[model samples]
Target chain A: MSTAEPPAVAPGATVAELGEEALIALITPMLPHAPGELVGSGDDCAVLALPDGCAALSTDVLVEGRHFRAHWSTGHDVGRRAAAQNLADAAAMGALPTALVVGLVMPPTTTVDWVRDFAAGLAAGCRECGAGVVGGDLSAGESLMVAVTVVGDLQGRAPVLRSGARPGDAVVHVGTLGRSAAGWALLEAGLAPRAETIARAAACLDAFRAPRPPLHAGPALAAAGASSMMDVSDSLLRDAGRIARASSVVLDLGEPEAVLGADVELLEEVAAVLPGTRPRELARWWVLTGGEDHGLLATVPQASLGSLPDGARVIGRVREASAQGPGVLVGGRSAGADLGWDHFG
Target chain B: MSTAEPPAVAPGATVAELGEEALIALITPMLPHAPGELVGSGDDCAVLALPDGCAALSTDVLVEGRHFRAHWSTGHDVGRRAAAQNLADAAAMGALPTALVVGLVMPPTTTVDWVRDFAAGLAAGCRECGAGVVGGDLSAGESLMVAVTVVGDLQGRAPVLRSGARPGDAVVHVGTLGRSAAGWALLEAGLAPRAETIARAAACLDAFRAPRPPLHAGPALAAAGASSMMDVSDSLLRDAGRIARASSVVLDLGEPEAVLGADVELLEEVAAVLPGTRPRELARWWVLTGGEDHGLLATVPQASLGSLPDGARVIGRVREASAQGPGVLVGGRSAGADLGWDHFG
Candidate 1:
């Protein structure tokens, strides 16, 4: 729980004194290069042989305070979060995580243990995701940041994107959403729920920390006659809006009660803590716009709906093409309370 | 070019308000997907297929001030530099650039234009290097940081690494070192040479800002029977130390005079402006510990030295494995003006 990093050097060593040329000296011996590496570390580029003439790729970055709380998440947690998020992006594309390259930056005061732990966490994420940390560069910074680029193997399946959705397709979801936001609302307010719920909300917090996306969802949806798909990274409505806009169609979400009805209990707790006294009000926002849970949102043929596994829902459908700025229709009702997050807004 | 970014936004719409999910949503729609993207954006993982059963890979990151000055370099410069460093790394490995995935974190106040310029800069780097920006991700953070992963094709050449040197090999170098360090010092001191040398040094400044590694060196070295090779990211001596350490041999560097003798006039002006007198002193430092020129340093069999192109130098030689740590020697001397940059130091 300590956010204590190693003490910084007095003003830290300038890159000049350390010498840029010698930067490669510390790393060249520790790597295990692939025999197929057309060119490995030590040169301008590292080349490799490609399989079946295709390349799969994804990227993610973990920032201090935003994606993680230094006091709570360890260097390992940060590393895991960085790798997992990027690996998940590749997975969302229906690619099998192949290999990864990491860009690490931290304050000079950071403990070597933190760096070592960070590497271990990265290795763990790579191992679990069927990827390896091929090579990387290190630098000093004012804050801790880890950016990971994950390469993937598609095994020849067509890449799944948000642009392929079609009218008459069933809107389905695999994995949970909105939990992280709901959990944050409670945590930031300094209100603890019942033991079980606190544990559940903590799961939500963990979801934000080290998210494990459904790696198989892209291929599964692609193979299951799904016309279009995308990872639900924004609010459900906002992400759905992307699908609708890309496909030039409309998404008619089912009843709000059917969508987030199961979360009424947690909402009631949040309601108790806040002056505003309605569970329904908070519950609706969670399902509609909550992002970062990394669940899959797909539009599949109705017949494929039966084939979906547990934890998925037939939440809505892709309607005929529409121009009302491609969006989600709640209970076939008015554009309801705000949908999701906006980066530039 | 104008480096002015977008003005700040109203409060509360901050990253925390939208969270990671919402932030990702804002960007997912803007990225263009490629056919080779077996896994595009979205999902836990992406699967890619390569024809030859191997993949080229490398990674690099850019911090706001450490790697570049936002005021000096545009957003495009940041992106181009980010891509160039990684692509150069791939090339150093004798790999042909193929695809790239970027992991970026920046302040929410950043403009869409800045991001575009950054992307444009990256595209320019890839195009100049004959590569492409294949995939990437965007997120919010307090500071601006960029992480890039580049993949390339090696055309079946053996990868050249820092550990491949053998005893009795001729140590050679192709490209300028010390230029970047010297240029950095000049700029920091607020001294400017004539536009031509200034431009050249500015190119060196650009080299440090957005390095374009000698992409051709890696594959060429492998084809030309290079025994060992590495990029001039650190100082020549320090990086040479890595190869020496890995190969358990001594790399005897000739006097700095032998290397910079021809370039004396060009360096004299640079030396005059600095308070520490003498051209040789400043020039010598350039040859010893400078970095980011993206040049190639290689070793070849003494018999095959004639095959090298012009602008190449036989800077030193390898000797019997040394009991002393793997390091550089000057006329069997080790004054040890420490070489290369280190993050934690």
Candidate 2:
């Protein structure tokens, strides 16, 4: 991360004070230029040429307090998270993210510097995944909220759907598991004790704030003959269960110790910083129920498993459903009570 | 309009009581499906086959209190208005509206019936403009907010831009001019008078509640060789000035009698229902500077003026910029105080 401090704002200066047109002008330059787009921002609509002739569309909404607390996250962090969540959806569909249309609903008290930083972070997020922020809308609201819609090109490849898993498929993942949850735990516990532990915790916090999903892994897996795919935004057990149900198969995730060896080590490092927590138990819980990591998860045929791209880890297998119904199982037992994040729960 | 009353919810039922999954299941059926879409809602991303190989995108955010009041407008009205605004942007770009991805943020106390009705209204709006609701995201927030992103197909035609207007072009418009503004005035005045006036007030209120833009006129104008085009979301003088500045020409909208004949009659009808307002003066004010009608405003070459489609009316003329700066002029002078709607100001 850059050590540069955020730009300062005038005391008590707000979005309402700056006015809509002035705020638009201020943030307009922060957007990165998108090549090949017929039109980009500043117009009634943004026009883009899709060479692949197919478009992948996805949208995600992040509300203040619910998604991210202002006290815990910077404006940049919020923007980055919002972009990552939506762009990750596009990547999960085996498409290359091309553009984003952002909608921001901010309170009048929001500072100009905050809005600018938010735009900067959005541009950075798009750059991270090889996309551009092409258009956006801004409005005043009672609380800060962001709605991001992403458009992607499939490049003539068939979209990888979650309902394609079959029996005898090897379930594999291509990004970090439980790191974001561990990071959330660390932040919640308020632990910043030793220097080494602080560095580990900082990494976890960064993962939680701005997820780095393996974007290329999606298309790689799709090309490698993966039977099914989805981004793991919810808990592995819950999200895997969705594939299981969708495909009418059972996903046996095996033991946590065997499946999440490296993740366990990271959780242990985080647990060492806190006093009354068991490292193994915490690791198991985070691996099973942690959400928001935005990792790409897919199922490959056993014969094609050798073609899995670098960083892919085999963790489970797809099997014919039995009497227990199609769902996720860990060590051959049902995962109950920890079914991941539910917005209205 | 359907005379069937909106469904009712139990007095104490809320979104929290129903849960996100249940709410989603209920509202999913309300969306109008796109026939050619490969993947629709319920997937990570909606996949659409675009025969034109190009897409026009636009987004708009509407906050509860800032854009609409729950007390003043029904949930359906809010949804329709949101859809209309985004779709109009697509039309202004001379694109055929294809799909919409909506992002909704509402308080937990919101009822299921309200959400369902909102979805119904969105579907109705899409049907009106020959589009489909392909995907969406819903989240809980402190207040009600809707962010709509629309995708449109250009049909292999060049996008109409605001910068394309030339001097001596005839400015024309299709759809209502100031009825929405007049309706807003009536709603603000809190007037509910006796029989005859009540009927007129109801018409004005309906105009404010649900704006029906001339979606078909967009492509027709483009086909008729319009020089420039835009949707009139802000007041006429203000929005016309945008075209003037963008095209480096001046828009001279002559007397209200010549520019807004039918609109004047409607404004007079609305003003007649009110007790202490002068119809002619109020008509001129609203016609000159009112907003939120979502009408199509375009400039066409003088030779193609005869090709203007039905419902389109000649409003003004584009002229070369002189000593006065390039912008809008009314009655041979700069429109001074009534510049148009400014969200912040």
Off by over 4 Å in 2: A1-12, A192-197, A272-275, B1-12, B192-199, B272-276, B336-338
RMSD values for the candidates in order, in angstroms, are 6.2, 4.2
Clashing pairs in 2: none
Expressed as tens digits, the lDDT of each residue in A151-266 for candidate 2 is 98888899988889999999999888888888777666765334224776777787787788888888888888888898888789888987887788998888877877867787
lDDT of 1 at A232: 74
Tell me the lDDT of model 2 at B126. 89
* Reference contacts preserved by each model: 0.69, 0.90
Per-residue lDDT over B86-130 for candidate 2, one digit per residue giving the tens place of the 0 to 100 score: 999999988888899999999998988788879888888889877
**What are the per-residue Cα lDDT tens digits for candidate 1 across B30-97?**
43433244544444334444445566677778788787777767877787777766766666666566
Superposed Cα RMSD, model 1? 6.2
True-vs-predicted CA distance for residue A106, candidate 2, Å: 0.7
